[model samples]
Target chain A: MKADPKGVLTGEHYLDGDFACAEGALAAGCRFFAGYPITPSTEVAERFSERIPEVGGIFIQMEDEMASMNAILGASWGGVKTMTSTSGPGFSLMMENIGLGAMMEVPCVVVNVQRGGPSTGLPTMVGQADMMQARWGSHGDYEIIALSPNSPQECFYVAIEAFNLAEKYRVPVFIMMDECVGHMTEKVIIPPAEEIELYPRRLTNSPPAEYLPYMPEDDLVPSMIIAGQGYKIHTTGLTHDERGYPVMTAEAQEKLVHRLINKIRLNADHIIHIEEEDTEGAEVVVVSYGISSRVALAAIDEARAAGIRVGRLRLITVWPFPEKRIRELAPKVKAFVVPEINYGQMVLEVERCAAGQAKTILVSHGGGDVHNPQDILEAIKESIK
Target chain B: MEQSRTEIKITGFGGQGVILAAYIIGKAAALFDKKEATLTQSFGPEARGGACSAQMVISNSKVLYPYVKRPQILVCLSQEAYNKFEPELISGGLLIIEKDLVKPKPAENGIQLLAIPATRIAEELGRRMVLNIVTVGFFTAVADVVGEEAVRGAIKDSVPKGTEDLNLKAFERGFQYGKNLREHGE
Candidate 1:
């Protein structure tokens, strides 16, 4: 479906990644935003507050991130596209409710403009340390989708993509942005409304009488219905039956949890998006995401000048891990060099997927800033040896 | 400007529009001049009275490394900023400063230095906040990374709605000063 013309601001803009992401959310038909202001991520909320009035939406400054997460979930259930943005500390606060949103099959967007972590480490610095946390922070066996954008232009598109995925999958999707990308300013071109595609909420056509909220359709994703539509519904985080009633039996837990996980796992191929360059028969491949991917390109150029057959595999969709591509490339490439702002988070997944068929090297940093291109180049050079 | 990439840095105490100046230059290059530019900034916790710096990289191709390694052009509006960032300028780089705010020692390694009284010019225009626009104009004429018309377009796009004329006048003053220095070796 085409985006709503009323919400779209189509033009060329010189904006930072945070502002661009907010614009993308608005363009994606996000009409409700509830978030507390935090550095780096605050711009997203600020932009929404400034523009939502003219866009005819609701912008609420919640007391805290916990309230922000819950409000978006409630707003999503009330049948509007919703989102919230935050950094490390706030992201941690949202995790428990994020798990609730997942269990309730709430479709919403959560953006984490990550900063150096382990507890408010660097408020104004860049970090990718939250990649693993983004995957598992909410707990349980349920699956969620995550995307990493490297530029302000990509941040705009990624926010829209995140909303679409959240609606389609009936899950809370994450936009895993870091401080570098969040604060970096660049040119972003927003296309016309008709050119932008949006995924409308998958509200059930089944009348209130026949609605069984937790029942999965052919795609393993159950259709959602707005609250107060009056067909007698129950939403809870506990294990439940298809009728949306809490059930204590082990069988109910198995059936509910399996479908929740399989909805994403079975559809992983469709949900995963990656960008590859020069990987065909290459000996060494650089696996990176978010801001690190752009930095790695510079090292790749230097390594190429020295005649190293280095390729690039950039994860546009960071979650679902693009496992098949990694497994396929692992056997062919001599080694995979993973450079991220965190100290060896995603490299573990690469190593597991490689399964000893090839070597996996981690060019790790503790964060506060991006890795120097020379350090990545040194890693690329060492991969051949 | 023949090089594929040109790195530029602007630094001052906060409330001096340091970041906005960088944003305008980057906007000129990326949005109007048909070049690629990336801008990043750093500042302390204090919102209005702390040291602030913004870095930009303009290139014909995509900028892979978002931060500047060694800036080829450095504009310092305060003495502290100059003292802090001067050593990071490349050997043959061009350094621009505010004559009233900064005191420089001696130039080394063939570095070209230009000074403009941007705050004074902005004050004369009845708005001291346009000082950044003045520096941007000076940069446009002396640095040669972005075209004058492009910077003009960016300024019109960026500044507040009613202040365009005053900012443009400030820009003209700085640009004229810079052109004179470059032409007759003032």
Candidate 2:
């Protein structure tokens, strides 16, 4: 269908926030979305069941989050781009599988439309508390790609980018669109079909017999052959040999796990993206991400207009921490301002990246009410003076 | 000579589809008309019976924030929303309320006010589910924020594949209702 450019229209038609999310997944070249319907998040599952088939893709509502996570991994092994969207409790269920995807080097996207939680905190309400959980949730010693989009439009593009990064590095990816952005509707530009860049599976001519799922000398990521492709391929949760077969010995396990984790961690410099504004000779700096980033922008911009030497650093990729860039700026900048839903998750990273070069301040907000640009701007003023 | 940003608030009960109405208005202003707009909805514990409001800011420049503290336009689909959000209405702002659902009447004499029977009009059109869309039709025709072409495009995707005709008819009726408001002095 040709996309409407004017970005508005009305009719007897109505859609809840969930259906738009399903559409976003489909448009992002997600060939598979495996999830079990759990309140709020179920809308994504229900819509995917109807829409994915229409797009010649697969949508399977797995029995549970664990099954859903593994199913996406299985689909990725079959050489298709796969994904799953879930919330907090279900996110807990999928953690072990996330660790496996990281170890196995499978490329896919996992969306956590976060709701409140110690466990099912507020099923229908919104929360940004999972900002830290996304980075350290799954038990692992590896780096992950996590994106938090402030709106649904960004959700569409970020979801596409999640798949792209996953494929580019051959690693699992995460999209952390909180309950607010995930369900919120905006005039999302469904870019004309020609503008979209969809990355297909990278296969090699080494053929079924010669293919080694874990052997790559040049590119950081290795190519794989599917189960029915006449390839003698092996996959594992256990540390394995180059051909992906599990070895009982510790030496092979150590080497395989080391390579898997190192692939993402060592290449962190390539994957990091942070947006900067008026930081030329910034004295006070405000750092934020996701929807909070919007307020940060306002805060910084308003401060600038008010003659405050305030700058903003908005993280595009929260994981793998953009430490190198922050470290580079440490000497030049005076102070660091970190605002997130959680009290001090990224603040720790910022303080470490600053390496005692600058004083760090934290502006935190939890569930009931989100902060305004004035609050952040006030912090910026206080930090500098 | 400076431009003042426009913030609009639309509110009603939870089941009234007020969020969708605010979203369509915001999308129209921001994406279709090439203006800057931000949309925000009321959330938290009292989300059921308490007044639900979605605020939108439309400007010719980048929207500084999404929070709408003072609104130039306020649409009330229920009485509670009218009372709760009425204080936020700007001087000489426009207020549109659903005649049947809200009572006690607003006391703001300076603001322009119009009352439409949205639910009753939608039920007459055969489906009450489109009460929000009906409200949107009135909004577009009254404010002229979104182009007719873009409104058609929004309607196509938002509505289901089968019921396009009824929606169009309802849109036309609601749009004309806004036009007829001043002519038939009630």
Per-model TM against the reference: 0.98, 0.88
Q: Clash number for every model?
A: 0, 7
TM-score of chain B of each: 0.95, 0.89
Give the fraction of native contacts in model 1: 0.76
Candidate 2 residue-wise lDDT, B13-110, digit = tens: 89888887777666656555666666767665576777898877777775545567888888999888888988888878888888898773555658
lDDT tens digits by residue: candidate 2, A272-331: 767888767888778777767876777777778778787778887888788887887788
Give model 1's docking category.
medium
Name the top TM-score candidate: 1
Error of 1 at B95 (Å): 0.5
Error of 2 at A185 (Å): 2.0
**Against the true two-chain complex, what DockQ does each candidate achieve?**
0.62, 0.31
User: What TM-score is obtained by chain A of candidate 2?
Assistant: 0.90
Candidate 2 fraction of reference contacts recovered: 0.28
In model 2, which regions exceed 4 Å deviation? A1-24, A38-43, A207-209, A248-250, B1-4, B42-52, B87-92, B109-111, B123-130, B141-157, B161-165, B183-185
